[model samples]
Target: MMRRVRAKKFLGQHFLEDLGIARRITESLSIPPSHVVEVGPGMGVLTQFLVQREDLDLYLVEIDSESVEYLHQHYPQLSNRIIEGDFLKFDFNKIFPDKFSIIGNFPYNISSQIFFKVFDNRNHVDKVVGMVQREVGRRIASGPGSKEYGILSVLLQSYYTIEYLMTVDEHVFSPPPKVKSGVIRLVRNEVDKLPCDERLFVKVVKAAFQHRRKTMRNSLKYVEFDHGAIMHLPVFDLRPEQMSVEAFQELTKLIEEHPLCE
Candidate 1:
């Protein structure tokens, strides 16, 4: 057996030990396979199965040096595919000139940031299959009106068709996390462009969700939009959590088109 790498607290490394779960996570990738990037592949549990898929050209990006070294010793077939760097800092376009999918057991500390990274590369990222804190997974897959829904729910749902896959118990990890883990997959939709100004759309969504408890009428004040006229609209009465992606899109347009331009 290869020497085990210690789970680093700072890196949020909870190495997944359940092989069945790993296989399930690996197989969750869609058919007609293409380029796949596995982030935070601690100890290569998932990599072991991902390597067998002849259809996929897989690359591993891990921030942990010890885990990376362990992967190097065990998965010699990986060769140059192992990247010793932060996935967030990586300019994936440099390594992946074309489209790709992402899959991994994402670190709890950086999972939200990771999705933001995914959102940045939505044009190239066709799908994402990640295991994260159960709460976060639910939040990503959640729809409007649910308490679990928030900023990420609204932003990511605007682009990807998110699905909550399954849950893994805390005990499944080598160093079990405090909470259960959930798997979620995001499949890109057919929306080439949205009806509203995309930049304003983000601003409106972020602003509204900043105070999720407040109505959009109150919360969106942070964005400095002239709410004088648009506040009369029925949507303003609803809280940020109550608004769907389409509702936010319309809200963005209303804000942009309002005559009170500063």
Candidate 2:
């Protein structure tokens, strides 16, 4: 048996130990025979299971130099595919050069940031399956009326069908996390439309949620727009979270058409 050292804390490393969990995570991904990308592949527990499947052209991205080298030496078949770099900093489109599936046991420290990164590459990544804090998993899959619904709920729902699969106990990891974690899958829909500048959409969503209690008329003040044009919007009295995704698209479309000319 490989003597795995304590998972690196600095990297938010919680190495998954349960083979059942590993198999279940991979099984959740129905990747085509062509390609898949796995991020934060610590100690190659999941990597071992993933590569054995003949269908996927599996690739691994690991940030820890020690683990990267260890994986390269132990999993000789993956030597060419193992990328040594921060997953947050790497450009997925440049590597895969085609649509792909993404899976990971993301570091808890930057798990939310990781979602934004995946959102950016939603076009290139057909689906995302990963483990994250249970709260975050709930927020992503949350609906309009739920308290967990916010910027992430709005932004992610605009592009993909987000679903919380199942929760894993803290004892499942090498070094148990303080909180339980859950796996989620984001499947892209062809019908999903950006409707406006996606970057701007996120900016607007964040601004509104930051003052979620305020009505759109009040929240609109935070975002740059022609007050005159915004007055023409159908429901200026509604709060940001109260509005649906379609309303956001319409508002952003109108706002962009009338940027505040300095």
Candidate 3:
């Protein structure tokens, strides 16, 4: 008899017990699926369905040793594919030399961090379909002018087109989470790279949102300058939340070209 794996709270493991929902999540993958990496796959709920598809070159990343052992024991065919490590640290370039997509019931705690990993390897990660805390999904899919539009929204939006897929109720999991979950998809867009310095772009976005309440003039004080040179620019009057991804890009270019106060 197979022993059931207990959900570890510290790992944010909310095992999706509903098979119907699991099947739906699996089907949500972008059509003509190529290589797919499943993150934090608990009890092979998603793995079971993913393996049924003959075309997908599937890989599983599980940090928990217990789950890894269970998956190995149950799914013998995936002998060398299951990676026993953290998805954040795992090198996508090593395993997938070309392109791949990501799919999972992401641990709510580390979902944001996972998105950051995707951003860093945007060139290789062509698409992503995953379940996350509802609020987090909303923020990721949100465009400018809304409260949910912030750092993650701006950063990822620059490179990918995000879609909020569905809202899932809390009752579907083994140990139900306090909050509902939502599914989202991100497809890599035509913009291969932003015209400005990528590192500077990230720094600018983070700085502005860190002081979101203040208008750009006050928030951008984090960015060193004479303070008077660019103050007359119309963007300086707007708050971080008001600026779009393009606006931030323009600001980054402006800062890059302008002289900084020593």
> Please, what are the lDDT tens digits per residue for candidate 3 over residues 9-127?
99999999889988988888855748999999979999999999977899999998889989998898996999999999999878988989999999988999999999999999889
- Report how far residue 78 has shifted in candidate 2, in Å: 0.4
Most accurate candidate by TM-score: 1
Find the 10 residues in a row with the least total lDDT in model 2: 1-10
Off by over 4 Å in 2: 232-234
TM-score to native of every candidate shown: 0.97, 0.92, 0.96
Give candidate 2's root-mean-square deviation (CA, Å).
2.0
Ranking by TM-score: 1, 3, 2
Task: Itemize residue pairs with steric clashes in candidate 1.
Answer: none
Angstrom error of the Cα, residue 112, model 2: value is: 1.1
Error of 1 at 112 (Å): 0.5
Indicate the worst ten consecutive residues by lDDT in candidate 3: 222-231
Overall lDDT per candidate, in order of appearance = 0.90, 0.84, 0.90
Can you tell me which runs of candidate 1 are displaced by over 4 Å? none
lDDT of 1 by residue, 74-192 (tens): 99988799999999998987988878999999999999999999998889999999999999999999988799998899889989999999999999897999999999999999988
